[model samples]
Target chain A: MAVSQRALEAAGLGGGRGRLERLRQWREQEHVFGYGLILPALVLLTCLVAYPFGMAIYFSLSDYWVGSPGQFVGLTNYREILGNDVFRQTVQNSFVFTGFALTLKTLLGVWLAVLLARDVRFKRVLRGAVLLPWVIPTALSTLGWWWMFDSLYSVVNWTAIRLGLISAPGPNWLGQTNYAMAAVIIVNVWRGLPFFAITVLAGLMSIPREFYEAAEVDGASSRQRFWHVTLPLLKPVLAVVILFSTIFTFSDFNIVQILTRGGPVNTTHLFATLAYQIGLQGGNLGQGAAISLFLFPMLAMVVFLQLRYIRRD
Target chain B: MASAASVRARRLRAALTYANLTPFVFFALFPFYFMFVTSFKRNAELYNLKAVPFWIQTGAITDHYDFLFRRTEFLIWMKNSLIVSVIAMSISLVIAILAGYSLARLRYRGVGSFGTAVFITYLVPPTLLFLPLSQVVNWLGLSDSIWALVVTYPTFLVPFSTWLLMGYFRTVPREVEECALVDGASRLQTLLRIVLPMAVPGVVCAALFGFTLCWNEFIYALTFVSQSGNKTAVVGVTADLIRGDIYYWGSLMAGAVLASVPIVVIYVWFLDYYVSGLTAGAVKG
Candidate 1:
């Protein structure tokens, strides 16, 4: 009784404390509705994301063909995949695709971002124009490129030959293994640059003008200012953008599958497409899942490290 | 004079800017220009190995568009895409607003931490999730329907939209809501009557993003829908153009151009939303 009385006196609720406590409780409940609002979104996320992800991991370890019962394989598939040449090549190709695409996208994105940052006439139109490739459905725009590169109907070849730039007629772009891969990479870089540009542009705009003015006052050259001022300030957002693009480019199936579908003797096969062939098309679910699951550990480690970096502020 | 020297320096800077931009402009514009010119050529003209095939030679060809529309399920595919994108956008945005409001304003235990965790979940690549998702779709018996996309898109869309809105909601002043609360309004009423009106720009941004995501998604649509009538615009164009052994180049280009039109229109309409939403919090940070 003494403790309650003391607490009431401290809170200024000793007299008519019951009514005061009820009003406070009601106010607290009212604010708690904020928590109540997120319930539906959480339910949807769990159902569609969390549950499916758990199922994918579970099925990756099992020898489950699509229509048949799954059996525990106990790393047997993983062991076999380690010995497979095609799977190894697919892994290598995925790395090459991601590596080359990331390098190109970042470089080009930075270049374009620098240009767009200048005070120019009709900059908005150019920015919007640049985003068209990124915005259009990957399959559709890639198909447009595919038709442009088709040996039989290639306007590029026809124009080149007619202009006397080449002696012979249309070159086989898709048929040649090397050219096919290069074409896909080029298309991927083209589509990705705008997104990188937009992101980097946002980053550039965010930087305070005071920094540049200070650098100018100190007689810093343009290159030095960019290297020291722009680069360091843009680091966090750039890290997020690059990490996103790397993960995306690594697992990209649409551009490759649309353009080549691992064609001309599987020269362009990446891990994701190979998984699709094995699991869905070729009907070897266990192997396909195993191939798809191959990149998970590496990605998880990288992403885990990145998450730490992002949270370390 | 020092003024003349400064003028020369200004010109030098301008020249340097031009030099830096040349490669980027050419690289960005060339292929699209190539596509635009190529789509106008007949098969014979395209095969002729000619320099600068005038796209509007005798007449700007309308045959490809006609053929694509008449010969394939292009119209139906377009309709399906519109339906799915609209429905998905509407559902995700509605859910996102409620969820975002709760997370931003509510002081429940774990709410702050949970908001960050949810945003991270949005970054989970659809590539990794699509395999198990196929099985989930099979279980739900929504295989080969546009409805499958509508159902699954929110898995990804809701997270990002909610996250985006949460950031936006944080900017809205708390006093406005407190004023509403003092006037005998409930939380829901305050959100609808007061908060949403002020948050229209943010809501529009979320809606635009949701719409674009649903419209452009290809992997899931390709994986899920195989039927001729139900395939979304992306799948329909690709599959129809390369049906069996034959590749119809003209019609495919036509379909590509047509498919891009709606996106262009949407972007133009909501240019402000794209700019603001895209640059949201970036400048401040």
Candidate 2:
């Protein structure tokens, strides 16, 4: 009680103790205090996230353009995009891009993380080296990839030819249909690999050494130990990494935009690049918003299911 | 002895790890090296069909770097990126610190739901919101300006840094905070003076990580700002440096290298904190 009185006094609430104390007491309640604390974040999100999201949905439903806000057509934009061949191809491209990129990143990421977890010399340097692609700006780094895949004076082709990996004048990476998708996927994997490896490495480091030793005592081979022990423990971390990476990969713009610009006949456009083309560049805001929001439902469901899965533990 | 064989096995495993790591490391690093090498080489060496592509046989030149600064607004773009990143990061950090503390420590109604909402917001990519946000930016008269980014970047940064800092704040001992409160400190004072100092690492981690995200942000930067003066470094290089069919390979690469080097240097200084921040967010978050 004395401490409470002193605290109130220190808060400059001694005079008019009745109302002041009551007000202080009211504000001091955990619920009110908590709300007050989070109020700034709440305001920022409501204005920036929630409000814009609502606007995005509205834009998708209406026949809006950059200059003119058209009347609401009620799913006409969605229907129109669903009927468009470019949009259809983009849908297919998004899945193929996300699917391949995620698979490669997962496989290579886990393998790299395992290698990183070893007690090797200069471990920090090696880890930093591996993370270069991830830490550098994506648009900037993708520009480098664009150069390497340049049709003329291509280093990738030069090296490949030197090593007998491919014949003279290799497939035009960004220009060809199949290789355009392949090029985007390769860059995506390269960029995403460090994220997976480092996050999973953290998971790997967290596992008790005794568990591995106990498995070893049971005569489990190295592969068996990884299968039974490391894999199970790494699931949550992997899930979180994959969940985030999936969203990032699906909405990837910088790689496709800078490298291909959804080019080679739009064979490599993801939802973002397609949305940018249709909405921003094409001035069809309604269709663009519709296309971009196309993945929101799927992503939300993934987040919902994955959150529940994580919360189970 | 079995011990000798075990040592041999371990050495072999170490050797194998190195061998496997070599290819991945090369894939990660070769691009940067190529970019750097390309940036310095003259047009003669850069365009030469016969010259070796791996390294420059001809001497390096600053012609590209000279062009980047002299002919283009590379410096201005970099300045925009720096300003946007620092200001946005500072704002998000302050907001995140408050929300993280409340979510982590306070016993409140709907706190759980609020926590989940923040996490979900982190999942909402800018691509989905950019169309509406472009309008919103225009509505507020911030379009074609750095203020547009300063205003919207927080939509993503706040949620992520808030969630991460919640995990960080939860690790801070409640007893210390309580002690401060009992001694006549107000709640706000306690948070600012007592709790914040202890979470310095988390704060630094959040700042460095958030700054990098801001610097690296592309789509919003590309879409929101269009004028040459207002563009961020990443967008400026891609948008301006590549004119027509004639590729400015040397200057474009110079721009890429210059844009990437600042982030690379910052990460090097705080690499462990970056990892620790991730572990906290991934494992605890």
Backbone clashes, each candidate:
3, 0
Candidate 2 lDDT tens digits, A1-313: 6687778789988774666668877887778889999999999999989998898899999999998998899989988888999889999999999999999999999999999999999999998888778889999999999999998877988988889999988889999999999999999999989889998999999999999999999999999999999999998888888887888889888899999999899899889999999899999999999999987976887788768976897
Residue B28's C-alpha lDDT in candidate 1?
Answer: 66
Tens digits of lDDT, candidate 1, B99-138: 9888877787888666766766766777777777877888
Misplaced by over 4 Å in model 2 are A1-22, B1-4, B245-247
Docking tier of model 2: it is high
Query: Interface RMSD in Å per candidate, to 1 decimal?
Result: 2.5, 1.1
Residues A116-209 of candidate 1: C-alpha lDDT, one tens digit per residue: 8887667777787777677767777787678778777565676677789986665688888888888889989988998888889988888899
- Among all windows of ten consecutive residues in candidate 2 chain A, which has the lowest summed lDDT? A12-21
Q: DockQ, in order, for the candidates?
A: 0.44, 0.82
Clashes of 1: 3
TM-score to true structure, per model: 0.89, 0.96
